[model samples]
Target: MKQFIVELINDRFMIAAVLLFGLGFMNLLLQKNLIKKIIGFNVMDSSIFLFLASQGYINGRIAPIITNGVFDAEVYINPIPSGLVLTGIVVSVSVTAFFLALTVRLYGIYKTVDFDEIMLLINKEAE
Candidate 1:
């Protein structure tokens, strides 16, 4: 248990990412407001990006930039995680924008951003 605790402490970034993800998940689950849910989604996305970035880094390795005519693979960190994080960021931004636009339209129609309220309003209108 002590060794596990020490290892967990050493991997600070991973621990932070997990905690952030938990917070975001809780926010997403508990929030009634659409905007807050969106914020939580963004937080979750950020945590994932952080995890990927941390995974891409090594303690002693340099970035994947080849220099000095050294072509050894061991000298540089893996570039895939960085690329994945970048792509995820772009996709998340687009998704977030789309969700915000939808929220705006929903608010315009329902007069409230609370998802439960919107559902109630819809049921009332249907009845």
Candidate 2:
């Protein structure tokens, strides 16, 4: 137990990110409210971004930007993954906006934002 816990402590940031993403998605699926589910989706998106950013950090490394003009020249950090994560963060922001719009439309159509109610109403309409 001690060894396992010790190992987990070293990688806890990643572990936490994974758990946050999973739990957020699970909540989105298990919840019955449209707004609540979208909030969960946003949480899941953030967890992924956090994971990516945290993974790029090294114990002792200088900034990747050479143009910054301040470095010991002995150590450098990788910039590729961090750039990708920046792009991902932008995408997450766009998706969140889109999801919010969808939620608004959902509210307009059903007059109630609850997923269960929406599903029941859609089912009734289809039949």
Candidate 3:
């Protein structure tokens, strides 16, 4: 048990990523406001990026850039995760912007950003 605790402490970034993911998932499920939901989505995206970055990093390895002509694979950390995190960030930002724009349009039409309120308004309009 003590060893497990130490290992967990050493892998703090992974633990933090998992905790952040859970928090974001809970927020996404429990929130009623459109803006809050979008924020939760962003949190989830960030957690995923953090997890990827942490997974790609090594204690003694350098970035995958060539230095002093050291053409050894073992000396450089994997670059895939860094690339993936960068791509994910771009996509996350675009998605977040789209969601916010949609929320704004909904607010303009219904005068409320709450999901329940919007449903109630729609139901009233239908009747």
Candidate 4:
């Protein structure tokens, strides 16, 4: 019964992740605002990260990070996904910062956040 419950939970989590990924991709493709696009990108990243972390978990397993010198491979969860999330967090931060900076510059030049409005403004200004 316990194992069945665990499998059911895992299946639900995977399904949710797949749905999130689909929505995130759709948002990324559909949104015109840079902020919305960045949010979608972050959501997509989170879905994958969650999936990785879930895979690292095991029943009755201790965390992978050892306190002393004891290396219990059989009971410990995988640390790779944690490390991966850390690196991804840093990368995502940098990307968001760069995107925001670009957005600010775009606004400065055109004084509009709307993509269509900015393009039209720039064209008119150019004429």
* lDDT agreement with native, every candidate: 0.95, 0.85, 0.95, 0.81
> Model 1, range 1-127, lDDT digits (tens) per residue?
9999999888999899999999999999999999999999999999999999999898799999877888998899989999999899999999999999999999889899999999999999999
- Tell me the tens digit of each residue's lDDT in model 3 across 1-127: 9999999999999999999999999989999998999899999999999999999998899999996999989999989999999999999999999999999999999999999999999999999
Error of 4 at 125 (Å): 5.9
Q: How far out, in Å, is residue 72 in model 4? A: 2.1
Candidate 4 per-residue lDDT over residues 1-127, each given as its tens digit? 9999988886876777788888888988888786787789888878877777777677787887688788768868878878887887888789888988998999888777777687788789899
Which regions of candidate 1 fall more than 4 Å away from where they truly are?
Answer: none
Q: Is candidate 2 or candidate 4 better by lDDT?
A: 2
Name the lDDT of candidate 1: 0.95
What's the C-alpha lDDT at position 114 in model 1? Answer: 96
Looking at model 4, residue 107 earns an lDDT score of 86
Residue 38 of model 1, lDDT score: 93
Candidate 2, 60-93: lDDT as tens digits: 8866877766765557776776898889889988
TM-scores for the candidates: 0.92, 0.85, 0.94, 0.79
Q: Which residue pairs in candidate 1 collide? A: none
Q: Looking at model 2, report the run of 10 residues with the lowest lDDT sum.
A: 67-76
